[model samples]
Structures are given as structure tokens and as C-alpha cells.
Target: MAKITFIEHNGTEHVVEVANGLTVMEAARDNNVPGIEADCGGACACSTCHVYLHPDWVEKVPAKDAMEEDMLDFAYQPDEVRSRLTCQIKVTDDLDGLIVQLPEKQI
Candidate 1:
């Protein structure tokens, strides 16, 4: 299982042990971690699951595709370097301690 820590805008943190192969959005939704609306499920069509990965963990994740990059452009809280759609992030054994921070709003 990968242990994920989701830090909310207000500094509250929620942590969960997510199963490998599951998307970060799925893990957040399943564990009731706030700030990850996952409005489009895990389809990567919506930017509602936007998150900011910790700087150290950024290089560990795969590069974002053009489509995902486009969707992120519509994110309410955009950060060119750290913003990401959580629905596109798959949990893996190597990501055991992934840490992500949620934006103030997803809309």
C-alpha cells in the first residue's frame, strides 16, 4: 500500500494507505479526504482533482501529457510547476509516501 498525505488549504492533513494501482483521486475519494472533488471520476477530463505535489515527489511522477496539461490550464488554482490532476496520478509501491497539497478551491 502507498501511504498518501493530503494537506488541505487550511493546513488540516488527511492520510490514507492506498492500494497500489489505484489513482490518487480514487484513494482520496475512497478515504474521504476533502478537497479532491474528483468530479470526472478518474477520467482525467476534469481539473476538479487538482493537487500540488511536494517538490521532492514531483520527479517521481510521470510527465503530464498534452491533454492533461490542457485540462490543468483550466484549474482554479494554477501552478505551472506543481499543479496536477490527481485523477491522472496512479499509486505505486515506489510512491509509498506521496505527499500532495490541495488547492483552496477546485472549481
Candidate 2:
């Protein structure tokens, strides 16, 4: 299992043990993390699950696909250099300690 830390806008943090092949959105939703609404599930159709990967950890994550990038344009917050849609981030052994910070809002 990979351990992913999700930091909410209020500074609250939620850590979940996610299985390989599971998306970060799945882990957060299953663990009841509040900020990730995952409105379109894991289909990459909505940016409600947008997250900002910690800068130090960005290099460890994979680059976003065109579909994910397009969806992120609709997010309430603009995509920063570290921005990513949690639904597109699949958990892997290499992402064992992945940390993602939530944006101020996701509407």
C-alpha cells in the first residue's frame, strides 16, 4: 500500500493507505477526505478533485495527460505548477509517501 497525505485548505491533514492501481481520488474518497468531491468519479471529467502536489514531491509524480489537463481548466482555482487532478494520479510503490495539498476551493 502507498501512504498518501492530503492537506485540506484549513490545514487539516488526512493520510490514507491506498492500494497500487488506485487513483488518489479513490483513496481520498474512500477515506472520507473532505476536500475532494470527485464529482465525476475518476473519469477525469471534472476538476473537483484538484490537488496541489507538494513541490518537493512533484518530480516523483507523473506528468498529466491531455484529458486531465483539459479538465483542470474548469477548477475553481487556477492550476499552479504543482496542480493535478487526484483522479488522474494512480498510486504506485514509487508514490508511497505522496503528499497533496488542497486548494482553497473546488466548485
Candidate 3:
């Protein structure tokens, strides 16, 4: 399992242990971490699971795919460099201690 730290726009933190192969959105839903709507259920069809990766992890995570990048256009307060749909981020042993910052909106 890998430890994922989710921080809210207001600075609240929800840290949870997520098993490998699961997406970050799954971790939030399983742990009841607020701000992760996951409206499309990790299909990369929606941006309700938008999050910003910490600078240290930006390059560690894989780059977004065409579909994911397109879907991100619907994300709330999207950031060109930092925005990412949590559903596309699969958990891995190498991603332990991953830090994801939530956006102010998920609608």
C-alpha cells in the first residue's frame, strides 16, 4: 500500500493508505475525503476529481493522455501545469507519500 495525502483548499488534510493498482479517486472515495466527486468513476470522462500534484511529484507521475487532457478542460479552476484528474493517477509503490492538493470546486 502507498500513503496518499490529500489537502483541501482550506488546508485540511486527509491522509490515507491506498493499495497499489487503485486510483487516487478511489482512495478518496474509500476514505471519504471531501472534494473528490469522481463523477465519471475513474473513466477519465469528467474532471470532478481534479487535483494538483506537489512539485516534487509532478514529474514522478506520468503525463496525462489525450483523453485525460481533454477532460481536464472541464475541471474547476484548471491549472495548465498542475491540473490532473485524480482518477487517472493509479497508485503504485513508487507513489508512496504522494501529495495531492484539491481544487476549490468539484462541480
- Which candidate number would show the highest lDDT if scored against the true structure? 3
Clashes of 1: 0
lDDT of each: 0.91, 0.90, 0.92
Model 1 lDDT per residue over 2-52, tens place: 999999999999989999899999999999998889888878888999999
Displacement of residue 34 (Cα, Å) in model 1 is 0.8
Task: List model 2 lDDT by residue over 1-107, tens digit each.
Answer: 89999999999999889999999999999999998999998898888999999998888899988898888889877655788999999899999989999999897
Query: TM-score of each candidate?
Result: 0.97, 0.95, 0.97
Worst 10 residues of 1 by lDDT: 37-46
lDDT of 3 by residue, 1-107 (tens): 99999999999999999999999999999999999999888888888999999889988998999999999888888888888899998999999999999999886
Is candidate 1 or 2 superior in lDDT? 1
Q: List ranges where model 3 is wrong by over 4 Å.
A: none
CA lDDT, candidate 3, residue 58:
88
User: lDDT (0-100) at residue 52 of candidate 1?
Assistant: 95
Error in Å for residue 61 of model 3: 0.4
